[model samples]
Target: MIGIDLGKIFKGNLKEAVNVVNRVKEEHRSYLYSGIGRASILLFKDDFEKSVAFIEKIPPSYRDFCYQGIFYETVMHFHKYSPINNGWDSEWDIAKVIELLEKVDEKYKSSSCFGIGRGIMSFEFYYAESRRYLFSDLVWKSGKALEGIEASLNGYCFQGIGVEYGRKLLNYFFAQDYFQPEQGYSLDNRFFSEPLNKEINRTLKGDKTLKGDDRENYYEGIKMAVLENFKDEKVRNYILNRIRERERSSGN
Candidate 1:
């Protein structure tokens, strides 16, 4: 797996890393591997323009698998380098980000892409609206949608969605316990919360009780629900511990 030590690269001056990434592109290679690496370099540099440019050049066939990896690395880099209290700093140009996302949507279409597309769409939606949407609307609304797509996609989709829900749930918990309800801390609460519960219900509907490894999906769904309902550090640690436990058990 191709990877970069983002922590090491973005430790000091972020601009220096951007320069390094820009310099590397002079090599003139445009393979999927090269695109992935270059995209990482641009993201670390916080050069959204360069990153989007590089990513847009990649063909659609390679994009389904590759784009998610690139986006995950970008988010991870931002989380480490420019985080706010519970979220990343929105320093990059939103218009540029939106434009890139539109390109991503067009290139990948909606069919045969499944989790990766949903994952990108989720993050983009969160970034655009400051809240998460229901998994069904995010993953299943498009024409010619994939069936059983959630099970087939990478665990990252579930994990990432869990993290976002966790963040929002913490916000809701904090607001109810301390802040004013009129403040709208759980902005878009209904959109995410309702479907989250519905997913758990659907998973266990009829005779399909969550069992064996299938239990993980149910747990992930529950974890997201809990994340939406709590925000304390204790709750955060507990949820994270549960996720780690599941990962270890899965041997992934």
Candidate 2:
């Protein structure tokens, strides 16, 4: 996984950082099919240039079967919206993000496999950008949208790119407090996490009566429990670990 240091960005100008993210959002308004995850990693990182350069070295034709358009779109969207300078601008930051994405594309094409490396790279970039605007109001809005998408995507893909991407999104949302205990808003943690847990329990208990919001609430409660209880590990990691253990025991 590509790790990002968000604490570094918080020491700088937070307002300006959020404004830049908002700019990117406005530029890529057309491509949004669902909510985008907001994370500190997306906002700040000193080694952004190095990260971009490394990913850019990859060819453009590479295909990320796991995330498909997600990798490309995320980079392009951020690049298109990022500010050239810390000041103001009507133009897009396409040059920088595109350059890096091109490298990602190349690397994927060379490997002939959609490795997690590309996804990690994209995530690092996103996190760095997001960190800069962590305290901004935009984070709340974007974070919620991201959580919604994640919950919606769950159970659709068991393994492979879809699952990986879903996990990333979940982690990002968790980090940003999108799943805050009892926080009201579209990004409320209950929407996805709680529902999944309920469904899992229902399946285990052989309870068919639990459906819709009831099942969703059960999952939400589980998510809240995990978040509240697990302070050291990330929410995604906790969930994935359980899934892995279950699969192993079940011989799946």
Candidate 3:
């Protein structure tokens, strides 16, 4: 839908985009066929006041998803919107996102953070698998996103990341049972952290090992860059120790 919306907006079809949203709305109140269109206008063209005004006009039940779409698109398309050319400047992108998210109502914040985390880890896996970035670079890039986020909301982000990785590695049913949130299942650090540990273990198997300062920096980067704002000592230590254990077991 992003592609369709992008084309419509690029061609100055703002009314067309609105008509599509309205058309979908008429079919079902809960059916939002395309959010990326609204998100693009929010992030690229509209100011915060306009963004807020636009969202205010939405049904209260649907506003949270609006915030989620805006933040998700911001993170999902970081490379395209990033200030740097041919390189990631995640800090710049993160700051831009947080500036808007911070002002959002507290009730809607967690969903947006979840989108941010999901967005970062999706690209992390993409860049790592495609060899578009070194593992170290990927760590730093994701760290920038994690670092700028609120400490309390980081788990929501991690849950999103875990859901992404779980979807790739596990069957559809298991992914929901384990990672996807539901009435009985709340977002927990373990739900997300464990999957991340598994992903790192698999990724490291075929990747070059970081040695000396590079190695230390890699772990430290995970510690400081990723966990500086995250206050869960148990989860924080668990991730660091797990990586060290994997490094030792593999004879890195």
Candidate 4:
């Protein structure tokens, strides 16, 4: 319900718009997520340092939200391969993003939790906990796989994708639902703001006919595939899952 001064921002007066957010935040510091989001808008519009400054003004606990990422372009750059952004410049100071996330992780570990001051932090952490996964060194791969999913879902033919890939896609959606149910329900809906429930429904049920031990085996196979391919270096489960799956299949 924060009334952002879009008029000031539309006039190219970012400072004024930011000041309005600051004043609003002062009165309602408990709900300062909107204010922090405003700063990110500026950051998206090429207002760099000041955006960071506004973010810095937010309580240290909430500063982690700042690191949650600002621009959709930045999010897509890491989370999707061929993302279509409205005004994303390739040369933007992506380092600043790393710097912010690093600072939040290294410096603000003990600060108050975002939304905790107002009793809403757990809701955010419960879903879309992207803050926990961010890093400066970039521990993830470009999501070219999203294209494969979209194509398979929208494509007329099954394209001979196996049970392993099918389970991987479904597992991914389940995890997303656990984090952000809305996004988990439909990638195109959450990310692209498109009405795409038909494709999403089709994808979710793409493997519905498989059952029993066959289904279990397929799920296990996809789990192994994801760990071996997309897992971060720090995840101990990657090595363990591979070894365990190998032993389980070999009857060792």
- How close is every model to the real structure, measured as TM-score? 0.30, 0.24, 0.48, 0.27
- Residues 1-252, candidate 2, lDDT per residue (tens digit)? 111122124225333333433455453421221111112224333344443333232222221221233333344344433333342212333344333334444433322112222232344335444655321222112222222222333222112122233334345545544454455323135665664454333222311223443233323333433453344454446464664454445443
Could you say which candidate leads in TM-score?
A: 3
User: What's the distance in Å from true for residue 6, model 4?
Assistant: 9.0
Instruction: Give candidate 3 regions above 4 Å deviation.
Output: 2-46, 76-93, 132-144, 168-252
Candidate 3, residues 139-217, lDDT tens digits: the string is 3455455667877776666555544443333332235336644422222556664555554554333224334333333
Which candidate model has the greater lDDT, 1 or 4? 1
Task: Write the residue-wise lDDT of candidate 4 on 1-252 in tens digits.
Answer: 232334224335544544554566353542335434443544455554555555564455545444332322222232212212321211212333333333333443222111111111111122223433211111011111212222212111121122224333434444544445444333334442222232233333323443333334433433444444433443325334543554455443
Top lDDT prediction, candidate number: 3
- Candidate achieving higher lDDT, 1 or 2: 1
lDDT score for residue 195 of model 2: 47
lDDT of 4: 0.33
The TM-score of predicted model 4 comes to: 0.27
Task: For each candidate in the order shown, give its overall lDDT on alpha carbons.
Answer: 0.39, 0.33, 0.52, 0.33
- Error (Å) of candidate 1 at residue 192 is 22
lDDT of 4 at 192: 24
